[model samples]
Target chain A: MATNTEITSRDSSAAERRGAGTAERRGNAGEPPIRPPVDIREDGEGITLCADMPGVSKDRLNLRVDGNTLVIEGTARLELAENEEALYADVRSSVYQRTFALSGELETGKIEATLKDGVLTVRIPKRLELRPRKIEVQAS
Target chain B: MFSIASSASDSLFDELWQLQQQVDELFGSWTSSSGGIRSLPRGSFPAVNIGHTPERVDVYLFAPGLDPKTLDISIQQNLLTVTGTREIPTEEQATYYRQERFSGEFRRVIALPEDIDPDRVHAKYRDGVVQIGVERREAARPRQIEIH
Candidate 1:
């Protein structure tokens, strides 16, 4: 969970910008944290967000939702023995941060998430009343 | 070994050397770089970082969502090759609005330095990271002198 409480929004960009949460970091860490690649799937029920964030462990992962904003922040770490010294690595920085704004139709409290093999999967289900329901028609 | 940069401003070789230096700074151990002016694919799966201590060469590969047992890491001659396939996690009937994650198969081969001893190699996968340690030959280890 992120307690820093910093939020920002971006609009009218080059591409079609949905009001979804923009990529922002809580604070400056070396090079700016990069936006990990994400896969978004939408069904009639709700939407699923899968983010590829390798080197991020469960202890270091911070996932929280503030109002309509969903924030995914994690610090990727390379664990080495006390005597080991790392000279070079390609994954430029160890910080990963991304945010997504949620629509009112989804249930924020019921979001289910799991971190496995470096991928973060978060499923947000639609509101119960908003979901497709069978309406009974009475004879007038 | 340091390369002498060509003074000719118009030489394409100079540009390649500069690019190599930049990559070296970023990736640390880019020991095998083809000089041809070809763009390295940005989506190379499981990006790796190579570093070394006095006793062993350490390689760390960042790849998430993997079945660790399926990954293959082998050493042939001086080249260390890692091969694996990544299956996209999604239902066939699911409607995808965005797919930016790299999926499918990937093979990453690293050229081990001459001083590394191929016989003493070790690898393990944990928490989405593949770590490898290759010991260096006895002669390659730095000898510290006792100050008289």
Candidate 2:
């Protein structure tokens, strides 16, 4: 379970959105972990969610919507083979994953995502009822 | 008779070689493990670069167009982990002539040296790149003492 501080902190900042709790268990002699940050912005119509995942190509990425939850997943292809040791390897290729729960007020079917210049953006539109509609008053 | 060989053929060969490399990459998934759960391979991982200075170790990652908020970084037991996910793109009533990019969850883990002091780690994000500065433990720093 995530702590309240963790939830709010994670939700509040661009760097905290992806809460990589692996540091808590680094004591284990296993592997280290990596978590990239994501940002979400909501406007009158919908919310724009952005993520940074480098080295992942269109063929390797996957997105799915299940019930009220949206899931994103991706894997980075190894540019160089194991036998070839790069003199300088500055990019880290790894798996990417994220999940967001949609409220009933949102129109799940209208959600859309796009990957441009290495950033993945998901736009989730709100339901008509949730949006502020112009109310017409009868002439008295 | 004209020369049988032409420059076009040479260029075609170059294109063929590039295409062959792409084809090879398509057949092979980015994943290194058979379990199919992990997004990528393990170890220091290749794409990221770590530089060591006299007082600190600098880690740099090449990531473009990624929102800083979606990134998560953790250092524990001399290991650093970065994890996050990318959503699939959707458009309404639009036809695509060509499309290629991967979207989904990803996790990257890097091993660290024992001389690092996690508490002193500082990170900066710029131009789609992440740079982390980890201060070295006192014992790890170079020291010169005068002979008595």
lDDT of 1 by residue, B1-148 (tens): 1233444543687788888787666444443363112213445677776666778888898888888887989998768889898888677777998898888888887776688888999988766888898999999888998999
* Candidate 1 local Cα displacement, residue B126, angstroms: 1.5
For each candidate, what TM-score against the reference? 0.75, 0.39
lDDT by residue for model 2 (B12-67), tens: 88898777565434323221322123224433222465556567766666656556
Q: Against the correct fold, how does model 1 do in TM-score?
A: 0.75
- Candidate 2 ranges with C-alpha deviation above 4 Å: A1-34, A85-93, A134-140, B1-47, B50-60, B66-148
Give per-residue CA lDDT, model 1, range A34-132, as digits (tens). Answer: 688999998778899989888776666667787899988776666554456445445556677899999999988788778887888888999978987
lDDT of each structure?
A: 0.71, 0.55
- Top candidate (DockQ): 1
Model 1 chain B: worst 10 consecutive residues (lDDT sum): B31-40
RMSD of each: 9.1, 16.4
